[model samples]
Target chain A: MSNLKKDSLFAGSVKDAAAGGLVALALFGMMIGMQADVATGLGGQLGINYRWGAVAIAVVIVFAGRLLLNLFVWKSDKPVTRTVGSLLPKASSFSGLGRFATPVFLVLAVVLPFLLTYFLGTRGSRQYLDLAILVTTYVMLGWGLNIVVGLAGLLDLGYVAFYAVGAYSYALLAQYFGFSFWVCLPLAGILAAFWGIILGFPVLRLRGDYLAIVTLAFGEIIRVVLLNWYDFTGGPDGLSNIPRPSFFGLDFERGEGNFADFFGLEYNSIHRIIFLYYVILAMALVTNLVTMRLRKLPIGRAWEALREDEIACRSLGINTTNTKLTAFALGAMFGGFAGSFFATRQGFISPESFTFMESAVILAIVVLGGLGSQIGVVIAAVVMIGGFEFFRGLEEYRMLVFGLLMVVIMVWRPRGLISVRTPSISLSGKAKGISADLVQEGHG
Target chain B: MSNWDNNPVLAIEHLTMRFGGLVAVGDLSFNVGRGDITALIGPNGAGKTTVFNCATGFYKPTEGRIVMNRANGEHYLLERMPDFQISAKAKVARTFQNIRLFGGMTLLENLMVAQHNPLMLASNFTIGGVFGLSGFKSAERKAVDKARYWLDKTGLLDRADGPAADLPYGDQRRLEIARAMCSGPELLCLDEPAAGLNPKESAELNTLLNAIRDEHATSILLIEHDMSVVMEISDHVVVLDYGEKISDGTPEQVKNDPKVIAAYLGVPDDEVDDVEEEVGL
Candidate 1:
């Protein structure tokens, strides 16, 4: 028999410790590289305290963690460990995880506000709810973009253009025409979808990188127009005092017929935060539900087919023009919905918020989620947005850690966190999801 | 020939296709008999695919009329319509030389997508589909039934749920044909269906083609390089050389035609007899 455990546990600790120490030192140094010692003319200076101590702790943690991981995981000779090491991750292995992940997430999301309020008190709960709302917004945007990029295989690098259209639509409509958030929401989606078709028609013949470039240009054009056309869009100053969404016309303000007052509860600011969290949670769920339903519909299957092979889709009598247009329009519609929600949430709208970087982030979320995988988008959005928020205190290292985490995840799971895709149609009794590897990359 | 319909299913009148300086197909004319297997054979660069492309509306011929007479007695000027309209309204479905099955989708989805136009109408543009209305549901059920029918006919019912690309090469070819059949095409154009098939698979293809012609009453226009398959299965043959039709007749007549032997053997017309003797055809 082959000697499975020849090396002693402590054989490489010193070398590993030294390597870990060097890495930790470099990381800590990067984390605290440049700082201004702001002294208030008191006895002490306010700056990063004991940068060396932080680095030492980081080194010790890395050394200990690396040693433990190497001893148990890398050196284990158990058959189970060997089997797991030998096994490649597959769509089948992760397929079961998807079945439970959504429900668990939904339940957790539903009870999160109540749980936080009960434990942290109302004043303390606002921050967590705010974070949850931010995460949910990105999740919603990811799902919306998933329709065009993931299911239809269209590479849209200017998705934020639609979000801008939506936000501007709500902002301009409310400012000029005195429309409520409820009325403006659908209008914004309609306007965004209209713009999507307008953008879609001229570029129907373009694919791949060319399509991406054109979409990026279109996004820039919208932003520029919003910036220049001060007369209609308030120019660079942006539109402020945008209306907030209410619960069936009951505002969450501290006046008569306010939500708290109508409900016979004391006027607490946390109610609005909690309410906003649920609103976004509900919108995200609806987006997920509609997308899931569309995945099983004929149009959805047509989108997948179009993605697989446009020539083949044409051969089969599918109207490729209409297919591409619908994907653009629908994806833009959802983006608009999220945009309107954003306008309501911020009570302000600006061209600066809908930048190309926003599009890149949303597109990254879709790709990292695995194209055409719904639940994958949720996980990716949480990881991306939540991680960015979590590392906010590490101002210098925030982007470094975030970028590193993304690179690690991508290297570990090249097909994104969840790569399994449910087939639009199945002939057997049950639907068997296919691996995303079997699918071709989206051309448009 | 017992059930062969005498009417001409597709008529190409003086079809000419040009790519800027090069004429891919020049003055190619032929008639595909209804429910008949017609083969278009040529050497490399003879532009057999260009003819297929023109006939299927993928390319509008530089000059000519492609008149397709459907089973419903509707006549269509195929060149005037877009590529998808040729398949959707003209009821002319085709497969590519490279076997263009939707590799990522289940075999069933590939067929269901072929029925997109009808399903789109049945779903009332997604309003009914979203609500799961019975009208749309029944239409979907029928579409599934049609897909299943074709899958069963192609002997791929067992692999219906798997990705179409996962099937072997020969099966992908059959799946392409089955997917076209799901659209209920009046004429099916196949490009090199027997190119990479084993002898057993080739024989199986023959059975499937004949069944489609005899049972389904679907006319076939195929561009094939395999002489044995063409000679064995095709009821009629058209030969092309240098983008021009050299011969058009029954298989036996085309096989013996001096011009076809000259085209295939790349010999002078007068020396065709000697070339034929050497080629042992």
Candidate 2:
């Protein structure tokens, strides 16, 4: 048994290294391309005193650097163990910390920005705050979809429909009734959840590809409705000049009634951005908490059972229709929250903001992170979103690079970044950490 | 035989299952006596599995009444119930011809899922489960204990955490039986449980069946091609040929019947005398 585990560990490390190497090589090639472009100006018409010898030297230097790093790691005894230990510091603690980790990380995420701004000062913190907020939103979206696609095994191609519903609900409600952000948030979630139930009822008998196609159609239908409904949604133009959230009636603008003036501090737009960041962070954390708790519940188990085998789940007396509906409702509710946050953040709402591309990116994060893994989703969001932002300078080739990266990661780990852990039901009625052996056994 | 007052747990009357013009089970009538291990034996396309499917509500009979009497005095018209509800509410559990345990789940989970109804009942539709209720926890613990108990019974306790598909063929067959037994059904229907099992595994299965009959008072209806398994464990044997009943009697009686011999041994009716003479029957 130990030998088998060791072999698997070895195989996993080798695959991970190969993926990392491919990513590094791609980045290196991009850097070389940029240098070449600088040497050869517009349309390759202007040429500088660039030598092919220098390019060869640069390539050799990079190759030697990579080889040396590989040799250092390979020469070290117990390289696999060392690599895995560094990658997953709490590998053994995963089972024990599974339940507590999500909440703990959530609290830390909420407090991290404030701590960073306080300690490091607010010099160029807006970018970091924006990245954090973006990552959090995707994390929430991934968790929401995980309920339907990961737990219930429902392929929802148009999950963005629910997200659009939430954003529009918030936009329309706040616009018409002059409601607060807090009030509009839950309203959006409720409306989106209602749509989820509606979607669920029609696809009760469908499974697999049929269910996926219907969901894709439903998404398109929602988008089309938003596009055609000129009176309510303003047609393709969408709702604009949406109200920004205030801090207890004190606006964040520069004036006597502004938030900074009320609090007796110098006004900076970063404050508003940071405040909004934390607000979205809190929302995302709540989404994660609810999903994690639900997973331990009977409904969660039913979803998993459905995913594993629907026929067997039915045989066990589980009401599959109810289970599927609950999954859809819960997932949609979170998507609604993200949508509301997006509307509030941008101070505008548009159909273009909730396109199918948004859904694809969110789904990609969920899949890359590992289905049903909260932490994996967060990490995936950070890497994919942060990488996309960083590669903005790459121009037309950015998407091509991102696509290659996705393919590389998928080939390296077909099961996703973090595979689903085996569920543990203790004899003492206490929840225990999921064991790796148990996960292997369950996934076999 | 026991008194007729102890009516059969499962009774199929005029059960006829047809696909297009091809009749799989035609006017089949049989009574699976309570606490009896009944074996249904037939050649390929003889409709033994078809009868099991009709009884389990997988394929509704074209013309039949499947009456199943639970030990709790609740009688279920199995043919009328949906496929899922039949196994859930009627307490009529069945194992497939090919072992069909949830391969992605652990061996223990496969068994626990079989006890799904009872667990859900204890948790009251899982409201208690969401609140982390102590009662639900206790119920979950009970499920785990039950799963472990059955795993031990099947000698698969050591492999409880392993995936069902990872088990060897014999172990997989045993695991399937354990999963069905975990459902706590009054009537258990096993389709070819002894298929691909060696002599030792077959003997072990016989022991398990006998134990289930004596301890749980489960009425077992089995479809088996292995004569040894049928002859050793079955209290009654029913033979089918061309979707029609050929013989129904005790194992010894069925073994001695000329029709059963011709159907199973493949000796032509006209040449049976010559074959019997040659074999010194």
Candidate 3:
């Protein structure tokens, strides 16, 4: 537009290009340069090949890319950020999007398995069906952790321990007592919730990083106990032949009077897979529904108040201990239900299945999904788990790509995908019709 | 005690609070009359807030008896009770000096959270609420009505939907008082409520606190540095110097007390007459 503006833009672009080029040179040079390569190709046998030429080319490409970005993307950053920053305050204050997001996501999830079956024709869509199941499990886990980390503002790094508790409870009961999957589902949840309360008591006084370390230790302690308690927990070998949930007491086994006969349809393994998908889908929806409802309750508001300021909540006469414990217990309850489903689906689990990495993945889902947002958790689970499943062939680079995507996302939206919050209760629901003039007319 | 009511709603006897090596409050003794506005005035860091914290059970007194007598014929030993019990059981409510309202929550939700104990019981531990039962539904409706009443009283009914943190400093102060009032406490303890308020907001706060005392019949123990607020609304004033009561009487008597003048001016006892004359006491 102006001479000064144009000159500054050019100067800034040059600076950006030079900085990007230097960074590229340093990174590529260390990673690719000065490395030993015994080459058998390019007319060489057991010869060390220097990649300085390739490294230079890469640095040049990076410089060009930065220059291009500076001209287009970076140039637009000011207007874009200005517009976004201006719009976010109004958008985040109160929006209709938060109300409709969950129902829309629920519809999509309900039709996902059917859609995959329709497009890929059931047999070819087995992997997609399994991926959907996996995604829903994480969605449930993310929603569960959303209660503690998002709503209550408690950093629980060992949430997977509750999952382990549920899975193992189901596994042990089914294996020892010959219990059905349905019989052990509630039992698993109860047992996991019991463990949640037990773990909650000692850490009630701890907050922030201290609480995180204690919960992390609790997770690891559970894993170690499961690994060493061989006689009771089946040790590292893990319990097998865990019973699968039947379709209303109808088995999917290949025998007379199986699920197919009961339904008067042809028997196929896809039937069981589809059934499992629906089961977890139902579980995830229930978790979402319960969390949404709880967000409106007194205890739910107490949890949020506690999150905002514990001393203030206590000063207001809220029982901080009960609030924190309820958050932990309820979060663990959902994790437990999901764990039971995980056990029934896999039919086997060991200490390796409930490692610290699992907790990290679930925590990442909640964080990246926008903490306290149910629909955000669903979308994030689909993106992360579905992306991992789809990129199975690129296994070596999957984590790197995933990490880069996460960094990019954090840079783009530090608060996560749906950071805007909608208050659970409002008096504005009535104030909408009343005029401000009338309100001011009566006031002193 | 000649013309004043003898029954005290809160009595702090020899209340001493120590932090390892330093004594924050030492042998402080005071009584807050029923339905009276009692002001606790002192210089900065004179353990004014420490006494409020001890009375509200935020800090346990090292060796003291802090007793609260509720109108319902219940007496609570505040030092022996947990912080929440001091408010919920002993009917004591408090506001923070820093204005610790739930920032992310709406103004209405912030007020509703103050009435958590009763609603929690009515909701049947959330089971009835989740099921949308008639009892819990009515209770929720009542909670909303109560929150709206407070919102209207604080002149925040129009902005009830906005986040509490988005409000300006003065509105936030009013909302904090409104939130504390929603709990319907017998004794309200406020810590520096007029710290950053302008003159107009301060006058408005004075009217509100006077209304609270006359109409709500709630006793108030206020920790304030604003002498205008203290002299305007306080029925009795207790001046503290280094965690000990230096003067306690009606505002006129305490204002003209020589020890209070010495404490306020940081002067020796012999120089109090000259300092009082210099300040036109």
Candidate 4:
């Protein structure tokens, strides 16, 4: 102690480093300190193997890392925001380059399939096109759920039930009624919106956790009904042989009277993929367009106002009942459209596809994109769905990476990416985005 | 009480609100004369808010009728209606004791939300908005103009684009009133408009309330604890104590009432009933 540096700052850094080492020890003690493996190379009983060296290394690294952070970041006199999240990047980029971000992304989405085909050629383009189609479907779903969770501030854990409804509506209608894909698409959306209203009525009075629990149960109930009702729905066998969407009335199945024959082009399966890609792109863009328009309408303002303060909304004579139901119906309508497209794209419908995890992922996209932000939904969907696909080879670490990313995002931008809100009706045409803190994230 | 034979915007007849066994308000009645400022004055927990809530359709009175009469001679049974109908069909607007501005919306947006009924009808319930109909566009412009008009009146036009949560305490209070006015209400109910304001702001609120009564055809009904505010601009005063009316008259008449003084100044317990009876409650 007598030989140690006299400076208090040095002492403080040492103390912080020591504390970090202790925390790392406490955290890693069980997970990494002792491994469960056979000590011998030969077959032996599985037992605890002490790895004190690993623990020692972890502690040393933690200590060194903490020391560096304290010296260069935390204790610096330059007013540093000392946190890993804050260290990454401030979410202040809603200006400058942000002005063109939407247009750039829109252009990229429109030309993605052709761009991929141009670069990767015929054989290689299929996989990337499929990935793009899958991501666009999720973008559509994220925007749909954004209506309920983001704009209206209603926490709906049963959102996938509407998706399931749309998928099944299209499948059953085609299988039984002999309807085409185009006919079933709008019908599927209508049916899903009807179900949304049915779900909305019972949960009208419930708020926060109660609403979440009911919606979760509702989603499960829909899946359970689909799974167990074998006679009409084919039970666990699931509905299959759903028809594909036609260009006007033309199919793309590499035969006479198909898309390629009609267009006088090669009968490549990539044509179908390309067509489906455009179909989903168009669908996703329609959802975005409708939602953006809604945000400026009285109904959209009513939804947002209800989210901010339901009592205030009611006091102002805004019909909260209609507002909530419209949110559910409109949100479910988009989910339904996406679901119908999903069924057509996959040519199969099953209960396994519409699970609670799907709802959570869509919700995660909405939350990560920032509630009430239309463009945020697009960015979050791409980053999450695309990133998930990118890490598909590392299946076990994929979730670990995803969870770590979520934690980082929560700490960094607590309100989600692009959290700031553009005012719906700005007197000054160029009014700046409202701070994320000023935007209501909704109670539920 | 001033007679409302010529006209009355709101009439609360035998209004009784009972929560379980406790009587929050019991057999209370008052009439707000058309285009006049009527103040409901009471101390803490004297059922002033309860009466306001009942009148605004937040609470259905256990018994009695809350009648709102428009200039067209159409009257609404307020307690029979929902909270929104009270504000919408009955043309009544209210502010909270604790301000309930849509904190996320801008001052202009907050007022525009109050004009939702009119704009919703004009936009054809949002379907027409998608098509960019000229009618809806013009309605939106008119709605903005109305919001701006209220904003200018409240002196918040400069900060119309700013978020409501960012306003100062006094400005937020005034903004609440402005938002209520944008609804085009025949009757406006204000709850503690001068709450938490300094003397200067309180005086400004007095001027604003007087200006509203003078300039607009809207009648004002308010719940106020601030005696200075109650006495300055009130055209009529109704005092409540322990869920019962102790006095009802003009501000000068009510201010000098012995029972009003006794209820406010806290007289001897034995003389309390005497004061209550002398006032014929």
For TM-score, the strongest prediction is 4
On lDDT, the stronger of 2 and 4 is 4
| Clash pairs (backbone) in predicted model 1 | A154-A444, A155-A444, A230-A235
lDDT of 1 by residue, B37-72 (tens): 999998988999999998888888899999999888
Where in model 4 is the C-alpha error above 4 Å?
Answer: A1-89, A96-98, B268-281
Worst 10 residues of 1 chain A by lDDT: A1-10
Global local distance difference test of model 1:
0.87
Q: What's the candidate order when arranged by decreasing DockQ?
A: 4, 1, 3, 2
Q: On DockQ, who's better, 2 or 3?
A: 3
Docking class of 2: acceptable
Q: What is the lDDT of residue A320 in candidate 1?
A: 88
Q: What would the TM-scores of all predictions be?
A: 0.88, 0.80, 0.91, 0.93
CAPRI quality band, candidate 3: medium
Stretches off by above 4 angstroms in model 3 are: A1-28, A36-49, A65-94, A430-444, B2-5, B267-281
List DockQ, one per candidate, in order. Answer: 0.69, 0.27, 0.54, 0.73
lDDT of 2 by residue, A126-183 (tens): 7778877887888889889977887777888789999999999999998889888889
Model 2, which residues run further than 4 Å from truth?
Answer: A1-108, A119-123, A246-268, A426-444, B1-6, B269-281
* Candidate with maximal lDDT: 4
Candidate 2 C-alpha lDDT tens digits along B5-85 = 257888888999999999998998888888889999989999988888888777888998999888888999988988778
* lDDT of candidate 3 over A75-177, digit per residue (tens): 8445455665676544244234556776877788788877888999978989888988898899999999999888888889999999999999999998889
iRMSD in angstroms, per model: 1.2, 4.1, 6.8, 0.9
Question: Alpha carbon lDDT of residue A303, candidate 4?
Answer: 91
Q: Which stretches of candidate 1 lie over 4 Å from their true place?
A: A1-91, B1-6, B267-280
The alpha-carbon lDDT assigned to residue A345 of candidate 1 equals 90
